[model samples]
Target: MQRRNFLRAAAIGAGVTAFGNTLTRTAMAAPAQNGPGPYGPLQPANANGIQLPAGFTSRVVARSGQQVAGYTWHNAPDGGAVFADGGGWIYVSNSEINPGGGVSALRFDADATITGAYRILANTRLNCAGGAMPWNKWLSCEEIDLGFVYETDPWGAAAVQRPAMGRFKHEAAAADPVRRAIYLTEDVPDGCLYRFLPTTWGDLSSGTLQVIRAGTATSGSFTWGTVPDPDGSPTATRNQVSGAKRFNGGEGLHYANDTAWFTTKGDNRVWQLNLAASTYELAYDDSLVSPGTAPLTGVDNVTGSSSGDLYVAEDGGNMEICVITPNDIVAPFLRVTGQSGSEITGPAFTPAGNRLYFSSQRGTSGSSSGGITYEVTGPFRS
Candidate 1:
């Protein structure tokens, strides 16, 4: 039987999902477990530029170049994640600006009200999409040659860079709790899908980096090949490797229900990989599915909802957060109007799962210098 079949069987027949002793029996994404219908049409957010489903409300939590409570909110805010704190949680966001780029964190109360904001990591370059770890930390990635992934403490503690994860135009990463592995995506036209098998689970200091070779669509077997040089040297690591499979601008990554989901911006496709068997299936392809059916374009950042649905942020298209159902039907979940050229990013949820958070990489100005982080509250799935 195919790997996907095995996963489905284990999830249904045994009433649990398991992945290599790393994962415990847990709920599938909220959308998949509770949904088959798309979200309702969007209602105008305001002249400040945002749209969302009825009953849903949004508020700006942080903005570029602004000072909040003695800390400066950095420019070009990109990928981010949320971690549970005492009564509330901490939201850490990446600054995609060069030279001065870094990561920032915000404190919120149980009511989703912002408490304070501060910078966590600094003096980096192009910190882009990153993933939250099972160990309660954030991996901030830089989009540059020999770029490294930084493990940052969400509480403004110390940060250490991990080059063992491989160096290239890094885009995003997702950790498979069951497999104890970190899956990564690159942002080049011919980027690759990779995974880092840490010498010890939950430790990013040492790991073996390998890239995946694609098989067929929706049900292809996958194989991994070692990355010659994880830290790009005289010659960039990606260019030095041979026989490594390439993806079209690999972008956002997330893990749900024993599967690793990633997006490819070049072709606007999202792939679902079964971690145990290392196999993948195409989840959504905009090119194959016309705009009339699914208006969302330029698929970039992705986040999974407890309802088992996936929310995708557009990098250039309608500037909307599109929802992808388990059945693969697509519809607009949230749209940012008046921001013609900017993209929506950093979609995350608080630990209690009551609030949804995201960012506009570029605000109404449509320039990198202008960006805003937002939080939305509604009847989110439990």
Candidate 2:
């Protein structure tokens, strides 16, 4: 098995979602990243205007409207994930530009050098956060009213739309291989958490979408109810299900080790859903930070390393990617100093876990046209 998959498979989730526990939160992040991080303190801003730890270096990989090698990079780059290729790997990113949003991919050599760049999906609208399937396809979602999810080929094949996943304001998708279900998040105040169970393991052509039976449930464990209409007709899919638990502005999601971790940008919180138990809790809550200092806010776009460290990027706060250890300590791993106006997005580590890639959706100009993608390399823990 690949080292990355092996690490995740070997992880033991801290599941507090026992069979008889009420819907409650477990304080995982204390003081909101005020503790000493494994990476130590970030050094002063370097030439790239980034504050990374000692021994770590940053370099610009691509910029909006600028040609990366040959292909022009897209604007408003958002959620991203990495896929393993023959000798190297590929990094796929979503473009959050309206009217002409889409997805793009960058090819890397085994040495982590960019070999090529190209578009994967196009002619879409407001393409936002997405999930990488075990089957190696990218589920690019749209963050608009009645949006859709497009499953695009990471290797430049034609994209296919999968409306069976629902047509609400989709933000992000997380596939749970253990349950053979795809968990989805809506980008609304009262949005619902959904799961699409395909007829088969790898085929997403058709499926039964269900909503979490929460909100009003006063039971030890929660369950899911069928979404009368996955098409989301007159009655929106979210509204169709009564008492479906609402996630405030859900932005990013990632599933591993039988636990699914997601973020709510509106509340500046990271949630933990124990798929094995069907119960969820707060992994990191800014409001619960001790001494009232929340180092990690604007919680968005979550990913984990093979070492079991959870990295949550900020959408607005300090433009930092805070690491939340399995032990629950949260601290800044890196920071973009001069791009305070731009939000961080698409944080993903390479398959070997040596290089980390992400983008500043608006860069220094703080406009959609000024997106800047970056790569950081060093002695990473995993």
Tens digit per residue, CA lDDT, model 1, 1-382: 2323111111111111111112232333211222223657777666556787777788888888888656788888889877877778888889888898889988877776678888889999999999887777889999987798999998888899998998889999887757778999999987888889999998999988888865434457878888777877876666665767778899999775577878998887877777666667666777556435556679998877655556888998988888776454577888888887688888887765568788898888888878988888887653
* Residues forming the 10-long window of minimal summed lDDT in candidate 1: 9-18
Candidate 2 C-alpha lDDT tens digits along 243-324: 7777789888877766677788878877766676666666677887765487899988988776667788999899999987
Q: How does candidate 1 score on lDDT?
A: 0.75
Candidate 1 RMSD to the real structure: 5.0
Residue 278, candidate 2: C-alpha displacement in angstroms: 1.8
Instruction: Give the C-alpha miss distance for residue 351 in model 1, angstroms.
Output: 1.3
The most accurate candidate by lDDT is: 2
lDDT of 2: 0.80
> CA lDDT of each candidate?
0.75, 0.80
